[model samples]
Target: MLPCPLPVFKGKNCRFDSCPSHESPPSSLLPSLLSELGVWTALLFSVESRLQKGQLLSLVPSQLAAFCCFSENQELKIMSGKPILHYFNGRGRMESVRWLLAAAGVEFEEKILKSAEDFENLVKGGNLMYQQVPMVEIDGLNLVQTRAILKYIAAKYNLYGKDLKEKALIDMYVEGMRDLNEMIMHYPLCYPGEEEKNLNFILERATERFFPVYEKALKSHGKNYLVGNQMSWADIQLFEAILMVEELKSDILSAFPKLQEFKARMSKLPSIQKFLKPGSQRKEMDPMGLEEVKKIFKVDEDLFLKHMS
Candidate 1:
């Protein structure tokens, strides 16, 4: 009834310090407050009623001009029809999707949540179809699941394949890369006293099991991609996974010459290069050191080593 008593507005150069809601509870508080079904529904009703009658112009705190401009621009953006990608502020399961979007040169909106509370707010609001992230809103459909989202975007851009056989091949490669990713996750890179054991397992078991498959695929595919001798969603998935492995072990790709070449090839692509550059959209890898883990977890080195051994 009182116009929600907050700005609830965002613009390119929004100045929050001078706004009445500047002292509003921590960012999470408002979302939590508005999340109540009754409260949010009422607020939305009021907002919608005002919007329909064009009486919303007089409801602002003297920032009417800015509000009007922001509203018009947002309408134009919505009318122009860009897809919206919703995910946490990490590359975990979204990098391949980002790659596909970037490579396809499609302009999409990113809703990158910065905190766990923000994600919970979305869940509480039922915005996510599966109550999980890495969801995307595109083509009038809200899609969930990383692989499904990636395949959908790729298919739209012709990166999935040109024929049934190629699609099957891409699926095979994508599944293999997923398995490889699972293996890479097994290494406790941050566990104290287990660094040696973890690194050894990574170098010995994981490398032995996964690297050769990728190497063979790259070799047979002419060193550019994993299937059809052209870029596909699988290639982007594998390349992004390789970047994660490199963050854990700098030399993970050293022994696999072909994989090394593949990394170089993928890195040189214009879309991927832009994605890798320093930016908020690019996922940050702040790997925890063994020493830090030792301190924080209070791990007894002797016991740890004995158990690991």
Candidate 2:
């Protein structure tokens, strides 16, 4: 039998199924390989030694290319048939995409860019279009745009709607959520002087205008999901958008009973539960700066409570 393509297994008994050229090593072997090769060095090895010994002579050109110096983590990821999601350390725009990925049960590697240098390198390497993040590398294709990525994953995992009209409705709902997001994203900096004004605008004008639309939509649908009696990309987007509002103000959604129930139901989903559990890629919910605003503006406690209420 041909030797296994893995370095540690290279010249030893090929423990993997179907010998060296199988689609993937057995899962039972993963613990040992991870220990021997380290995480990043997972599958790559110098094949020159194996070539001189004629161990890999049966491999095709494509197989040989895969066995080259490049890391096999990507290959293994492809073998697992899941995508790699690249985003900044913070949730930001990628939260919905992450939610969709989890809800769809698509295993994905989260590449968190924690520094400006890391982001710049990715942009300089031409991996990101227009130098923006929330990019996904899946099945040999790199995709950008949060909505597009979510749609692609949803379609892949069958989380999207069942028909064309259902898809259109899903798109419509997602667009509305994006509109609400745009309002809050208007001033991410939240300058101390404008913090109270911005909060008031969101509470009074934006909330008044947007929240009722969603509340009505939820009641009209009369389902746990936002669209078509099932979870879709739209549901995930709206959920994350509501989460952002919750982070900004704890009591914002109390008035909308249907939405409160909707949030509770989605949070209870198995995939969402796994995503929310500690030690995952999930980040702590930011207070969205009510306290920071009070401290920065030196506002009195009583006055702050009155404004927030």
Using lDDT as the measure, which candidate wins?
Answer: 2
Q: 1-309 in candidate 1: lDDT tens per residue? A: 123234654344323445423222233443554454232221221322223211222221111211122232222101324568876454455656776787666667888665546666767777566666677877657788777788888987779878999899889878877776655544544356887776676566447876788888878757478877788887888887788678767898878999988888888888878777786356565343334423422346443221110
When summed lDDT is taken over every stretch of 10 residues in candidate 1, the lowest stretch is: 60-69
Query: Over 4 Å off in model 1, which ranges?
Result: 1-80, 115-117, 185-195, 221-223, 287-309
Misplaced by over 4 Å in model 2 are 1-78, 185-187, 285-309
Instruction: Point to the candidate with the largest TM-score.
Output: 2
Error of 1 at 138 (Å): 1.5
TM-score of each: 0.62, 0.67
Candidate lDDT scores, in order, read 0.60, 0.63
Clashes in model 1: which pairs?
Answer: none
